[model samples]
Target: MAKRARPGMRRKAIVLRDIDPPGTLATNLFRAVYNPVVQAWASGAERIIAAYAATVSEMTTDAPADVRAEIDGAAEQINRLVLLLTPDLRRWALSVEGYVRGRWRGAVLSATGVDLQTVIGPEDARQTLANYVEWNANLVADVSAQAKQRIGNAVFSGLSQRKPAREVAKDIREAVSMSRARSVRIASHQLSSLSGELARERRREAGLEVFAWHHSRKAHPRQDHVVRDGKLYTENPALVGKKVDGIEVRAAPPADDRAGVKPFCGCRERAVMVFEFDD
Candidate 1:
């Protein structure tokens, strides 16, 4: 038998749709910067990669220094790319915040007969979230930086082995592709994690003690989280060990294993307003 959602429980999906657009835009922005830059490295006679390859063909030791300089330049370019994406990422996070605030306010009022005051109010949380957006945006930048390093190493190693410019270009393209994929993952994870964290704080502030485990009904859901769906748990027990389903005590979920948190499971919490209102 299915347990119907109790009062104050909002399906996390209502806000899940808000997670993807900015991530998509971030990916597109990254690709715009990543693809052309990498392509320029290996193209025409004057191309950076072509020039480096030519030096190696001529058996010149000076090629290493020149290529190193180019590598450093590429790294700086990757750093600057973060500036372009940060604004959009911050806006996306704030949009998620707006939706979560709306969802939480409506749910709490409907269930508790009291309008809950936000403990994690925007005044306190805004700067923190902005910093979070900056941090996550840097994550995308880091991927590109790492990709640049790989391209440098691959080009030098390949040329020394007498590999063609086209071969080195292949490796460079693969690195760019990998970096783009990682940027997408970082964006998606940041949005979902931010949403869940903000919601968790709101629940705590409202004095909600128990919450239903809501499995993300996305394709290929994790089985453990799926099993937890509709069950109740409390993070109120010192924010560490928790009471699961009101039947057994369990440790707080490990940081990496946090249900519906980022970089892993997407499961979310549906706070249950079990408080008695003094009318």
Candidate 2:
């Protein structure tokens, strides 16, 4: 005979299953920013690569000075390209911040049915937006600097090897291609992390009692052990004197490693709402 399930257990299962997971806002924003930056970088890199390839044969040990100058010039051009793109990158950061902020506000409302504007003042929202914008801007600048360094190193190594001009040019092109792929991965991971952090912060401000970790289901094996599906945690454990406004929430023990906080993590957090009065 089939056994009947307990009413309380059934309701708990439904609530867990009904919780909304994090969206793809971060990935989308990463792609939006990465595409244009890569396109522009490719265009500039081609010009630099071509110029080097044309003059590579002139870089013999006897005429090393001219070759060195050419390499330096290429590096200078890469830096200049990054500088030229800064303003546009900053603009994109601001746009992404605004979009993420809106999503944060909406997520809080959906979870607790309380508008963030009513709980947290407008000034706090603006400050949060500003923080996200600054974070993205810094990420862009860091990626750009890393790219320039990689290109410079490739050029130096190729020229130093006294290889044929065409071969050296090929090396530089390959380096740039690898760097482009890496930068996209890095940017995507960082953006997702930022999104998760913002969501957690807004939920806390909205007075949500507990937050659950939501895995992407597509996460690698290493991340699977960090937090099981539907696991929850308290926002502050040290505040013993603080008044508790909601039911005590608990979950599996915290992981020893910071898997979800690292780069390339796809995990997100969901606010676990506990209502004082039944709806």
Q: Give one digit per residue, the lDDT tens place, for model 2 in 143-235.
A: 555655665666667666756666666766676677668766766665665555556555566555555666656636444545455555564
lDDT of 1 by residue, 1-279 (tens): 012225564432111112222345434444543344334333321345665667667767787677667767766765665567666666666766766777776665554445545443565458657776777666666666677777777777876787777777677677666765665665566656777777776766655565666777879887887877766566556533443334332344566666557464567777664433112
Off by over 4 Å in 1: 1-47, 83-89, 109-121, 127-131, 238-252, 275-279
The candidate maximizing TM-score is: 1
TM-score, predicted candidate 2 vs. hidden true structure: 0.68
- TM-scores for all candidates: the values are 0.72, 0.68
* Root-mean-square deviation of every model: 6.5, 7.4
- What local distance difference test score does each model get? 0.59, 0.53
lDDT, model 1, position 267: 77
Error of 2 at 262 (Å): 1.0
Residue 71, candidate 2: Cα error in Å is 4.2
Q: Give the worst 10-residue stretch by lDDT in candidate 2.
A: 1-10
Candidate 2 ranges beyond 4 A from true positions: 1-41, 60-63, 77-132, 219-221, 224-226, 238-260, 276-279
